[model samples]
Target: MLPSIGMALVLLFSMSGCGEEDRRGVLFKGVVAPPGIVMVAGGREHTLALMADGTVWGRGSNFYGELGDGTTLNSLTLVQTVGLGDVATIAAGGLFSMAVKKDGTVWAWGYNGFGALGDGTTTDRWSPVQLQGLSDVTTVSISGYHTLALTHAGTIWAWGYNARGQLGDGTIEDRLTPVPVAGLTNVVAVSASTSGQYSLALKSDGSVWAWGSNSSGELGDGTWLERSTPAPVQGLTDIVSIAAARRHGMALKRDGTLWAWGANYYGQLGNGTRTSTRAPVKVQEPSGVISLMGGEDHSVALKLDGTVWTWGVNDQGQLGAGRDDIDSVIPLKVLRLTEVSAISAAWTHAMAMKQDGTVWAWGLNNRGQLGDGTTTNRNIPAEFLGL
Candidate 1:
């Protein structure tokens, strides 16, 4: 959400956490917001923003209280998430949210029908609740009904939905608490699909591993079969990052090249084709990429040059090219956007964070996930009000 004009005008001043006298020798009291937002993430319908002050704000779908505002009311404006602070990073799932604080503790809220909350129960939480027995967490990732946490020690822990073996514990049983992913160590990153049916992990050794559903070959192990444990993604190495969609997977290699596999019925593979591959296929785009994100059937990439590109499904103008529902089988530069520092793609919408710290959004906004204080779908990128 963008900072409102009233909020911007009311910003008296911000002080550091140390409480030392500022060089300006000025002070203010009873203020909440910090300087600006540092990061933004999009869920199935909700949106989450992390401010420089370490607090989180959420908007959109709150039927299951994914907003974590201690209420089930949907919001068109941003609301401070209840009881979350000192947060280092945050992740949003299909109907849930997770945050990792500076103290290394993890917290979760929202839908828990499959025990995705990791609170030892299948009850929904309307507010942030400390995830039991998880600490030293370096990062967290969430999907439809599960969550994954990477520890400073390089081990991977998973919980929640395990159907299709997404939990990676060599079982299909749902877990209410965290469980160590069997046979995985030195892991640097992890990702889960929006369907909670597949998962991927990147190791420090530059290798990629995958498990869970392969109904569309999302596991990318040169097979169309599901695995209850982690398996090396065929022919992919020297990888730096990975992303998982509902039925497809993406990997960014150290060379800045992108690779993809699995479902491509909508040309999500970005290979100028709509064929599904059981093994990784090189994405048809120039290198120099810094990051990539996958939607349920589309993909977005942020180049090192600070430009954003997207491909695949555009039924909702998700490509941000001002085109009306025209799918692209190749990467298309997002029209009129530059200096993007980060990007996120949801089930049908997309978001971008400019280097200047302002947020922009396009595509599906039926729930005001765009945070522009409206529920209109955008075919072109527009400044989202209230950072």
Candidate 2:
């Protein structure tokens, strides 16, 4: 169903006026982006890519360096995250690695424990530091150890591991730097969760908001009680796209449908049912989805015809589906992939990008994160030519 997709970080603040220049050089609001391999991120096994000439590339587990390349030593080849170049967007957490350059400023590298590398302290970087209070910052999100930033002024900034409040700011304590998530304003888009607790936002009026630890309901807002602030995710609205994982959360509606809510055990809310639900609920067969990712248990979509649909936990295959013991509550079909533009998933592994940029990966390649040098665990898709 991939109907000509592209555009995954979706935050749009207008401004493209002076011609073109944002291949990660997002400056203030132009967001231009259209060149090659715009985004891909994953952490827990490590993998990253940002190129449109902005530079930033990585491979599997660099222990704590999370492959920012300063040397925590864990490679499968593909390197180059050192001094950084334009780097418009790239994020991966739970082990750390973040970038948001192109001048908006924000950088980080590998696991800073509860500090999530906000850079104020907890110290764990091996390279790429810059995060000092954040700057123009257009986009950033990191699940499972906290991190969220979105700033062309629409507001939102948070820092590492906030227990269950996931840094929403009303307080679960634990931030090591940047803070401001209380009232939330224009908030174009944001998503955080992978075990780091919870979060979700997207408001240009499309409405969808949520805040930390709903135990298993994942803050879809039907109520499991746990929000340090934020709140509105009930039936959803125009919702262009959203995804969160630590339990579950998925949104996408401007007619293309797809909805989800809270922990489905291992079903990851594809809607075929593993029970858990707190509010929304629609995802079943694949749809025109466009793009979405949220993997701790699983959920990935990309349709309109580019073909790539996944469902919950395929154990180690992460549902590429050709094998790996089975676990789909609904959406499947990921084998040979297709046009796929971009996609990313964490923990169990999944990565994709190929509008000629190549790169494909499958679940749990142990520490090699499927760069193809192999730690072996693919239920399907494999091509990953280095970066």
Candidate 3:
């Protein structure tokens, strides 16, 4: 049996601890995008920012040296990552980080228990090390412990943890080196869930494909069976972008419509219901959305008006709902947050870049992941001072 879920879901609890208290994140303020940052990303307990000058800055938990600064000391302020320049893209996994240089070379550091560093070994790195046989890479994505890289040639290669087949390599075995993904081409983008055992890819034709754990129907395949190979997400077309979390998948269509499927234990699916679904359901609110981001068990939307909104679990203000320890099954505006050029949502905190180039952050500050020179969690957005 599927077991009883609230409303239209099942399963008593997420095997990955998707309970009432597990969801949380930091917030940011000040319309915050500091002058040169082109992008931001977060791991389980750290953050990284890429600048227009092709350099990287980071703060928060550096345990396992995810900050790539050759140390594990957490930072309450942004610190430059050592020995990297001309970086074109950056990504963070649970406790590791990776970057793609302008020349299309990939480099990684931090937690290597599952060989997420892609150096063909299970050893931690305090500094960035280039991966072998991976070049001309255009971008990369990281989930809990696995990673996916998209090359300039429009092909996908992946490595690291694959307990749930998130690698799309037609096997469940973990990899210490990059393996070409099967049956996918002209791929424009890919996303690996924060901690879920699944991955998603968007092709140039506006179709989406998914693989790995299907528990709670996260794969959107109208079934609960897990897959080691890629499968098309049914009924989705014209998808411009996609995002994934621990147990759900979100998509934004060309028409600005937002849709989601999978676990709704905390209403992370954002369909005005607490029930999970095996098929796509329209997000009740948030129209004119230009982008979508998925936290551990929450959802974030960036609108055409440069405004931001969030919903689902607020245990640590991951929803930025203006108060802590609350959960909203429907969309709620992130109070007074606007003119945001971009946003990065993660397991315990979030960062936003404003039109002015100042970065702001909020949510769980444990380990100083908020990078506001404090370890206090914010129920609302807070400006990160002193850059």
Candidate 4:
């Protein structure tokens, strides 16, 4: 039986009553993109920008023309994603990109080394190509070497690296096309860490499932064993959302609490220490968290009160607090910044959109991913321009 979802009606242009409309299609249980931005927090070598009109802009690390800018030439400037409009969300892998259109179609570009493009070919594309054989895609998630999609019909599909069964097809052979993730049904959303070697699934009933590499207990099943198929993350239920990083995972409980597990070498787990955990542990934060993003070495959370909190590695100033000395093991407030409505993190930098439609960025700027008109790193959040 399909899980029952409570519905609330929300007006798109109005902040109040947003929950009403937000829950409209919850019953269908399709792919759920990471809140706000689509790029993996620290896995994306490029930056993805979403315009007000639903167009997308991408720049940086186009090693394979992953930017979908029609050129392999690396871009330090924003290049509008060609041939796409009415996009609802966008994501980038190591050298590939994906976007879910407003009409539920998925588009991809860049390297197809392992068939990550899901276009039924190994040919790399310098321009956007619509994914073959599926529609009603609600969310698209990309990792360093793979891709995953969730459809409105409550099914999941994956492509790319399968060396460790990361593709979850019970095989170690890589695929050059999309393949169904066996045994999963009524799935609401799917997430892949930057590595594309493990995954998490959120079902319609608010339960979480995991597969792929579990050497570090990232699967959250209480045992560090690799799973070739979906397995429930022990004791985890009623999850509203989930996200993954290189070796860490995080989820927001239905009641607005945040929990994390797996790698914490840089304190990405938000437990006030660098110790690794094998199971979900509550993140130490003072406010109720509405959403969470797990970066390669840091984590960000959007609070119910419109404030943003960050923790983990500050080596590249990814924490956006104007100093690299404070490696926040616990959620600390970002100063001089407020009214943030959405946040996205790239390989090293982070972008936050304000309630007024302005964007702000901070952290590593070596590749000009920060879009602040320069390549120099900024330790504090700075306004972004060029739309």
Where in model 3 is the C-alpha error above 4 Å? 1-35
Q: Supply every candidate's count of residue pairs whose N, Cα or C atoms clash at under 3 angstroms.
A: 6, 12, 21, 5
Candidate 2 accuracy as lDDT: 0.79
In order, candidate lDDTs are 0.86, 0.79, 0.82, 0.75
lDDT of 4 by residue, 276-370 (tens): 88789888874577777766678888887777788888887888887975688888777667887777766556777778766788887765667
Which 10 residues in a row give candidate 3 its minimum summed lDDT?
1-10
Q: What is the TM-score of each candidate against the true structure?
A: 0.91, 0.35, 0.90, 0.86
Model 3 lDDT per residue over 1-387, tens place? 111111111113232554311221122122232346688887777788888888887777666778887765556667667899999999987878999999999999988877788999989898899999999899998886889999988899999888888898899999999998889999999999987489999999999999999988999999998998899998999999999988999999999999999999998888888999988899988899998988889888999898888888888887777898888888898876889988889886777778887767777877666767777888778876655
Supply the global lDDT for candidate 4. Answer: 0.75
In model 1, the runs with Cα more than 4 Å from the true position are: 1-33
Best model number under lDDT: 1
CA-only RMSD, every prediction: 8.7, 16.2, 8.6, 12.6
What are the per-residue Cα lDDT tens digits for candidate 2 across 278-335? 8989988777777788888898888878888989878788888788767888888898
Best candidate per TM-score, number? 1
Give Cα distance to truth, residue 221, candidate 3, Å. 0.3
